[model samples]
Target: MGTDISRPEHPPLARRHAWSLAAYRHMLRKRLTGQPAADLKSIADKRWDIAPGEITVSPPAIYLPGQMERVTGWEGQRFYPYVHPGPTMAGGLSIEQGPTRGYLIKNVWLIDGALYKGNASHWLTLKPQRFAPVLVENEIERGAIYCTQNGNSWFGTWLMEDCVTYALACDEGVPVTSAPSARYPLFTQAPPYEDWLGMNPLRLRTAFFHQLVLFDDVSHNRSRHQRYRAMGDKLLTHVEHAPHPGVFILRGHEGDLRLLRNELEVAEHMCVKWGFRVINPLRLDVPTIIAACAGARVVMGVEGSQLVHGVNVLQPGGTVFTLQPPNRFISYYKYMTDRDGQHFAFVVGTPDGDGFTIDINEVERTMDLLPKH
Candidate 1:
C-alpha cells in the first residue's frame, strides 16, 4: 500500500478466472441452500465439553511485563475439560481478551493491575490475585486440539498469538491424558474452510518443556523466538526425512485452490531459475514441514497462514519474502518476521479477481539482492 519503489507492477489479467469460480460457487450454494451459511455453522456438529472442577491442579502463574501480584484468581486454578469454542459469534460466548494473553478462562481476562470479569454463566467476578488448585484438561488426548482453520488467515496470530497460549498451558506441568490408542480424531470434525497442515497436538505436547513461561506473540521478540525455536528443533526429531540446507518456496493451499494467482507457476519458475525448492507444506506431515522450515536459509511464499512456520523454524536473521495481495494490505507477517530477527521484505502485486499476480521481473530483482544459497 505504501509507495515503496521495490514493489512490483503486475499486468491485469484479461479473464478473472478466480472471480468466476467464486461466483459459480456462490450461485451454486444459493441454488442449493437458498443462502450462505454464516455464524459458524461449520462447527455445528462438533461439540466440546467444558466440565468445571474436573481435576483441580495448581499450576504456576505466568507473569508479563507490567503486572503486580500474579494475575491468578480465576485462571491458574481451573482446567477446562474440552473448551472448544470457535471465534466470537453474536449472542454466543464471546471470549474476552485476557490481560496477559488470549482466551484462557471463561468471562475473565487479565490486563495489567486489575482483572476484568464478565457475567454468571459467561460471567465471574475478579478476585485479588491468588493461587489455588483448579481443574485442567489436555484437549489433545480427549479428542482433538482446537485451532483456527484457515490458510489465508493471519499466520502470526494463529501461531504466535493464539497457539502460544496452548503451549504456555502445557508448560505449567498440568496433568494430561495420553494420546489416543486408535485413530486420531481431527481437531474439528467439520471440513476445513481453508487448507491447513494436519497436526496432532500430541506432538506439540511432547515438545513442550514443563516450565512456567508466558508468551505474547513470541515471534515478535528475538529472545522469545529462541525459546520457540528450541521447541521447533525438538519437534524436528520426529521428521524421518528432511533436507539439511535448503531454500523453501511455500505453496499456499493444497490440491486445487491457491491464495495467489499464478503462485504455482511462480514457484516452478523460481525453482527452475534459482534452484529454490518448492514445497506444498500441507502435503507433508507436520514434523517434516517443521524440519524443512528449521533448516532453510530462505522462505518465500504468498502472505498466508503457512508463514507461521517461519516463526517457529527459520533461524534468526533468516530471510523471508512475503508476496502480498495488492488489493489487500496486511502487515502481520512483516512485523512478525521482523520481530523474530528475520530480514523481511514485501512485494505487492496486482489483484486478478479473487487472487493476485506477482511480477516475475520484480521477483528476480529481489532474488538477486538476497544472499546466495
Candidate 2:
C-alpha cells in the first residue's frame, strides 16, 4: 500500500527536505503502528547501526525485549538462536546487539536451510522483509525458541547491506524486496579467516553468488497448464517417433497439483504418441534440476518456484510455457525476460466455464514467435 503526504505548491529546498522527512517519518509510523509498544521501542533503538568489536553480554544489550514479538508471527513456525562465542568467533556477528544504542545497524543477515549445508539456494532468493530479527532473550530464557513463537533465525537474516539500507532508507517502504536474495552460498571448507585462527571451524565463510529467477505474475495459471498440454500434443503430431529432446514438467504444492498432474499425463500421452521422453524432476536438488532442464528443448510448468528453475536451466531460445496464477501479485517473469534478454513466452490465461483453460490457439501463436535455438 502507498502512503500519502502533503507537499508545498512551490517547494523550496528546505520545504522539499521537510516534505521528504515527513514522508519518511510517516512511512516508519505506518510500519510501527501495528507493532507491540515494547517491540516498537526496541526496533526504534536497535534499528540503527553498530560497528565491529562491539560486545553485548546481556540479552537486553542485544535485543529489546518487546521487539521480538513484532518481528515474527504465525507463518515463520519456529525461531532458532545462536551465539558467536568470542574464542573462535565462528558464528556470524549478531546485528541485533551492539555497544552504541543509536548507531545505524548494518551487515546483519539471515539465510534458510542448514546453516552450512549444500542445497540452500532457496535461502538466496528471499527478499529482506522475509527476515525477522533474532531474539536472544527468548532463546536464553526459554531454552528453545521457535520461529512461530515470534523470533528470527540465521536463515531469515539478510546480509546484503545495500539492499537493507535502501529498504530502510525509504521511510515506511516494504522491506521484503530489499532482503538479500536467498541465492548466496556458504563455503564448505574453512577459508583464510578461519584458517588464520588455527581453528577448525564447522563451516567456511558465506559467499553471495548465484543468479536468481523470480516469477511475479500468475494471471494465467490454469490456462498456461492447458496450453502446455496442447503444445505437447501439437509437437507430438509432427513427430513420427518420440522426439530426441525430452520434456520436463515442474510444479510446486501451492496451486492445483491435480491439474498439473493431468497436464503431465497429457504430455506423457503425447510423448507416447510421438515417441518423445517425458521427465518429471520431482523436488530434485537445484543443480541436478537445472542440469536436466538445461538439456531439454522445452520446459513447462505451473507458475511457481520450479518455473524459476526453468528460467535458469532452459537453453537460451529454449521454450518456457509458464502457467500463471489467477491473481497477479508481482511480475518477476517480465523482469527476467526484459532484463536478461531471455527468450520465452508469457501466456495470460482466461477462466473457462468449467475451470480454467489456456487458449490453445494463443499458445501456438506465441510458440510461433519464439526464437529458434
Candidate 3:
C-alpha cells in the first residue's frame, strides 16, 4: 500500500538526504522546545529567489494545465504537454506570496511552503502531494484572511478547495488558517492534528497573511479559474439539479481500497448497463456529496479523490468519465474537465495486484462515445 508510484521519479540523493535530515531534525527539535528557528542566514530574500520557469503565482495558488488538453486512458498511454514543473517533480518552496515570515516544515525540508525564502513551487495539491505546514509572518493580518489546508484532507471538496474557500472568502473577520489555530469554518478530516495536538497549541500556526490557491492549481487552470468558478458557483446554490444523473463514483470501503478488485462488480455493472447512480463520495456528507453530484449529465469515476465531486458539479455539457488503472495512469481531472468545457474520457484498467481491472467492454465502448444530448 506504499511506494512504487511507478517508481523512479527520482527520489534519491540518499533518499533526498533522508528527507532533509528528518526535516532538519524537526527544526532542531523546534529549537529545543523554545521553538523559534528560521535564521537561514536571515533569509537574504531576493523577493525570495525562485527559478525553473513559468512562475506567476497568487490567487488560490494559480492553476496549471496546458497543452491542448484531451487525454484518454488506453492506447500506449502517454500524454505530455504541461511542462516546467520539473526541477525535481517541480522542485520546492514556491508560495509566491504568503504568511511570509517563514518556517513551516512537514515531510521535511527544501524548506516547505510559506517560506519567505526559496525552494521554487509545487504544493498545489491533488495527487501532486506535499505542502501543508505553515508559519509565514510577513505581517499582513490587517483585514485578517489567512487560510491553510494545502491538500488531501481526505476530501469534502478538499475542505471546499483547501480550507473552505478562504473562510468562504471571509469578511466578518478572523478566519485564520495554519495550524489548528483559528478554525470554525470547519470541513472535517485531516485537521485533527491529534485533536489539535490535544486541545490546541501548535500545528505550526503563524500566517502573517495568506490567501493562496492550489486546488491542484485550480485543477490545472482554465474554467475561468475564478476561485474555482466562484467555487463552482457556490456549490451550485446548494445543489438540486439532477436529471440525466449517471453518477457512478464508487471507491467504496474507502481509504486505499483503490485495490479495486471487483468493486462490487464495478458497482453492479454501472447499475445494470449504464443506467448508473452508484455514488459513495466516501459515504456522503459534503452536502450529501453535493447533492449526489448535482445536476450531473454523467460523472463516472475511478481515478480517485472521489472525482472531486465530479469536478465541482458535472452539468455543463457533462462527461468526466475516468476508470484508469494502468497502474495509475491519472489525468489530473483533465485539467478541470478541459477548462470546464467538459467531456474527458478514460478506460485503461488491467493491472490487478495493487488493484486494477475495468474494461466492461471498454465500459461499453466508452459509453458509446457519450455526448448525444
Candidate 4:
C-alpha cells in the first residue's frame, strides 16, 4: 500500500487558493453553536446485525506505464467499514469533502436544537474526514438529503455510491421534504436515474442536511457487488439509446486539480486509434450525458467520479481505463466494475508541470490489455 495522500509536489496554485478560502469557511462553521461526535459508532440510532462487521476483499489491480506487474489500491491495506448502518438506512447524514469551499464536518449527533455528541474529523492529517457528518447552515426538519463527493477524489468521495446499492433496501422513498413541514428540495427531484449503476433507484426526499438522512456506504465492504449492475440495467432500460462502442470521459468542470497535461494529445489517440467517443461530462446535462453513454461498451478517463457515466452504461463485456494521478489512487470505480462484469485498468503517469502526462506507449499497452471485444 504505497497509497498515501501526501503529495511529493504541491497542488496547482488555484487549488491552494481554494483550500485557503475553505480554511476561513471551516473557521466560521466551527463557531456554529453545533456539536460533533468523537466516534460515529457510539451514536448509531440503529445497526444491522446481519451485516458483517469486517470482511476482506481482493484489491483492484492498478497499472503503471512501465511495469508488467500491476500495483493495487490507495492505502494498500484492506479497509473495513468501522460500522454498518444496514440497508435502506435512514438517519442523519452529513459529509464535508474538505475544509475548503463546501461544507464543514460535524460529529456530534443533535438530539434537540443544541444537544450534541461526537467529534468531527480533523481537516488535515489528524483525524480523517470520511466518517464525519457535514455541518450545514441549517438542518432538515424532515426527509433524507444527498451529499456525495464526486471526484472519486481526495475530496472524500463518500457513500452516495453506497446509497445506490445498500439503499436498495427501498426502491421508492416518499419525497416528503417538499411538504410544508419538510423543507429540503434534496438532490433528486426524481430518482437520479442518471447516477444509478444497479440496485433499486435511490429516491431522495431531502437535501442540505436532514434531521433524518437516508443514505448508505459500502465502499468499506466493496466486495458485495451486484446491485450496482442491476441499477445499470435500470438506467439502460430508461435510456433505450446507444452510443459509440468506445468512450473517453473528460473531467470537464472539475477544474485543473489533476489535469492531464497532454489530455488533447491523449484524447486524439483514444479517438483516432480506439474510436472512442469523447465526453466532457460538465458540458452535458444528466439526460444528455446518459444518452451519450447509454450503450457505450468502454469508458476511460482520469480517475474521477465523471467516469460513472460510462461505467454505469457498460454491459457484460466492457472496459474502463482510469488515468490515475499518482498522489490520488482510488479504486472506487473498480469496485463498481469488478464482480459486476467489466475489465478495469489504470495507468499511473509521470508528473508533469501542474498536472501529469500519460504515455502514448502506456495507452497502447493498456489498450492491448483490454479484454478483446
Q: Give TM per candidate.
A: 0.48, 0.36, 0.30, 0.58
TM-score, cand. 4 vs. native: 0.58
Which tens-of-lDDT digit does each residue in 166-279 have in candidate 4?
343232121111211122222331245434433222231112222333333434332234455566666777666765667888884374476888887887788999787787
Which residue pairs does candidate 1 place in steric collision?
Answer: 77-134, 79-135, 79-136, 99-110, 99-111, 118-123, 119-123, 120-123
**Model 4 spans with C-alpha error above 4 angstroms:** 1-41, 50-216, 219-224, 242-244, 252-256
Per TM-score, the best of the predicted structures is 4
- What's the lDDT for candidate 2? 0.30
Candidate 2: Cα lDDT at 243:
19
Residue 284, candidate 1: alpha-carbon lDDT: 62
Which portions of model 2 show Cα errors greater than 4 Å?
1-246, 252-262, 269-277, 283-288, 325-330, 352-355, 359-361
Report the C-alpha lDDT of model 2 over 77-195, residue by residue, as the tens digit.
Answer: 12111322121111223332222112121111122211111211122232322233321110000000001111111211211111122212222211122212244433222132123
Q: CA shift at 103, candidate 2, in angstroms?
A: 12
Candidate 2 clashes: the total is 44
Report the error of model 2 at residue 357, Å: 2.6
Q: Please provide, for model 1 over 279-368, each residue's C-alpha lDDT reduced to its tens digit, 9 standing for 90 to 100.
A: 766666554556566566667787655666644666666677767664444444444444455565556676577667877777777666
Query: In model 4, which range of ten residues has the least summed lDDT?
Result: 95-104
Which ranges of candidate 1 are over 4 A from the true structure? 1-156, 171-219, 239-258, 371-373
Q: On TM-score, who's better, 2 or 4?
A: 4
lDDT for each of the candidates? 0.40, 0.30, 0.44, 0.46
